[model samples]
Target: MKIMVLSSYAPTLFLFREDMMNAMLENGHQVIAAAPEPEEEWESKFKKRNIKYVSIKGIERTGANPIKDIKGFFSILKAIKREKPDKIIAYQAKTIAYGCIAAKILNVNEIYALMGGLGSIIRNKNKKSLARNILKAEYKIAFKSCNKVFFQNKDDCNEAVGTGLIKNEKIVMINGSGVNLEKFTKKQIPAKPVFLFIGRILKDKGVIEYIKAAETVKERYPEARIQILGSFDTNPTAIKEEYIYKYVNEGLIEYLGSTNDVRPYLEKCQVFVLPSYHEGTSKSMLEAMATGRPIITTDAPGCREPVINEGNGFLVPVSNVEKLAEKMIWMIEHQDKVEEMGRESLKICREKYDVKKVNDVILKTMDLKKVRKNQNVI
Candidate 1:
């Protein structure tokens, strides 16, 4: 079977869905990645794997950009025509919407939209605005058109149904794109307490809360280190450049620009924190768990699933700086518990988020066996 995978961020796909891709390729299916033109570094990595790749223009998030939407739809339509893939797998909102539209036009047999995360546009409670309405409409079109919608967390699945975005029966919940235990192996806890927040340096990711928590913790434990990785995104919720600079200059966080490898940092940290507003199931959180680092994340949707609260880590309410700070401080004060929680984290991740197991379930749902049998018969 020829499978065309579409996403705005190709590196994200490589990071989260690499196992699935390798499994599909190993099973003798042709895999073609259709996404934004990746950076040279990412493109080089893809080329090294000898995977076929194509570039498409698509918005990263929900916005009132019909002009771009129409253009992206047609761009994807052309790719569909050229590839004539037997199946299409779309990830994230924009790519999923455009991919579904193109698949419907090209009459593709199987289509799957991976709702990795709902993002702030769709999930934001305060929605009395034109942009919100436009985003809602986009959801209706994109989700309704897909053959199946794969969600990462129960909250997203329930919300999609409650909002009539997609039927409950149409949704399948999978572990946040399963983590690669091999790539992110267990590590020894560092002596000095280091808390890491690894995600897009967006305001919605609770960057402000992280900074506040870092400051509070630092005041008491002066030697405690906090690091924020991931790039500044152009998303509406992204942290403003000025605010980022201010925080950095004030010595609140040691900012390490985005890097291909995060394991080194993961290994160096005693605890990982992600105060995200929401998530589809944060790959980074799972990576942190796999690396045996206790977590501190929000109690919202995708963000809440990974941490078992005082078992593997603590959970704070979304955007609650005081609560986030308290949780971080708890981990700092009870440093001995860090290793125990890290052990629990590793246990949970290895048990529930084994990449191969999740990918197998996905393949079964897509009827890979039946498809393969039919092809062989032909």
Candidate 2:
């Protein structure tokens, strides 16, 4: 089988789907990735793995010129015809919408659309915006054309169903892209309570709330550590760099900056926190669980899935800095439960979200088993 996975961002595929592509390759299927041109380091890594890549720029969010969008659609269709892939899996908003259109023309046997998040298009309160309305229509068409629509959370699945974007049978739920357990294994919980946040610094990701909560926690547990590691995003909702710098300078939180590997920092943390407004299934939360770090996230959709309050960690109201702070304070006051919660976090990941297990479900949903069984080529 030949499979092409497409996304708008380089980091997303490099970080999340690279292992899955390698797994498919090990199983004797050809794999290729289509993404925006990545940095030299990412390009080098792909070359080392012998993964083919096609650079498709200007296909990002807010780059919605109809002319470029039309060109992108046909360009992808041409690529599909040339590669003749048996399946195409797409992530991110624009890629999924266009990939579905191209797959229809190419008559691809299987198309998997990953709704990583409903994103601002649907999550934003303003439903009357022209862009949002257009996006909604595009999603309806994309979902109708997809062989399987993968959702990270129940809310996204339910929303799509309610909007008549997809039939109940077409939706498949998976843990937010599974974490690499071996890569993010258990570590010794820090001697002093440490709370870490890892994700792009976007307003919708609740960076402001996390900052306020950190300040509140410090008032009670002055020795408590709060660290944030992630790059600023170009998304409209991104936090200003100056604000992040101010927080770092004020000792509200230690900004460790972004890194390719987060495991080293996760090892030194007792709690992983993400007070994001929502998520498809937060990959960072999954990694925190795999690394045996207790989690404290919001009670909203995608963010709440990995947490079982009092078992792994706690959940507070989204955007409520005071409540988030109280939860952090509780974690600090009862430091003895850190490791116990960490143990439970790891247990949950191992049982419910092992990468192999989640990837297997994706393969089965694509009907790869039936395809191979009928071919009987092995």
Candidate 3:
């Protein structure tokens, strides 16, 4: 059988779904990965894994643009026509929405999708926009043909049902993409307290709050190291590069830019923080937890999943600078308890967010076992 994986970002396939796809390959399936142009040596990276890379252009990953959407839809349509895959798995907004429709047009019934998050526009709970309405309409049209729709959190699933995109029968909830326990082993906590935040430098990610809190926290506890690790994004809620530079230049924050591997940074920090507006499931947080670092995150959907208030770490209100700083200060004051909480974090990660455990659930749902049985019987 031929299985095609659709992704808006190239790294997502390797970073998130590599285990599942590799499992499929081992089960006697040809795996073809489709996405926009990659950043570095991803084409070679995929080739190294024996996965075919298909580059489809005109995919605007962050925002909604009609010209780009139309072009992306056709590009996917052409790719689907040419590859003629037996099954397709697509994630992210553009890839799921357009890829599903393209597969349907070609009469492919084995279409599956993962809603990582509803997208940045829908993250705002207060305001409603025309873009949200358009997305709802597109989701409604495309989801009718999906065999199963995997979601990282229940809130995202409920939101989809509320929008009438698909019925309850189609929903499958799993932990975020999950973390590689072997890759992110727990290291010794740093001597002095250090707080780390790793994510795209976007306003919706609570970066502004992190900066403000970092400034305040620095004045109170100057020894506490605050660092931000991520690249500037093109999302509408993305902050200008100058803002990040302003804080970094002023010595309020340490900007580490981006890296293919985050384990070293995860090892350096005593605590991890992400005040995101929302998430499908936060892979970065899970990685930190696997590295035996306690968490401080927002109470919103995906952000709130792994935390047990006052247990592993604290959960601050979204966009609350004061509360965010309070938790950071608490961690600094009580260094002895920090390691205990980190142990709990590592425990939780192993129980629930281990990559192998999560991939087993996905493989079972995808009917890999049943397929293998059929093949053997023949």
- Highest-scoring model, lDDT: 3
Tell me each candidate's RMSD, in Å, in order: 2.9, 2.9, 2.9
User: How far is 363's C-alpha from truth in model 2 (Å)?
Assistant: 0.8
Superposed Cα deviation of residue 183, candidate 3 (Å): 1.3
Per-structure clash totals for the candidates: 1, 0, 0
Question: Model 3 shows how many backbone clashes?
Answer: 0
Give per-residue CA lDDT, model 1, range 246-326, as digits (tens): 877988778888998999989888899999888889988999999899999999999888789889998899989889889
TM-score list, all predictions: 0.93, 0.94, 0.95
lDDT comparison, 1 vs 3, better candidate: 3
Identify the superior model by lDDT, candidate 1 or candidate 2: 2
Q: Pick the candidate with the highest TM-score.
A: 3
Ranking by lDDT: 3, 2, 1
Ranking by TM-score: 3, 2, 1
**Worst ten-residue run, lDDT, model 1?**
369-378
Off by over 4 Å in 3: 38-41, 125-128, 370-378
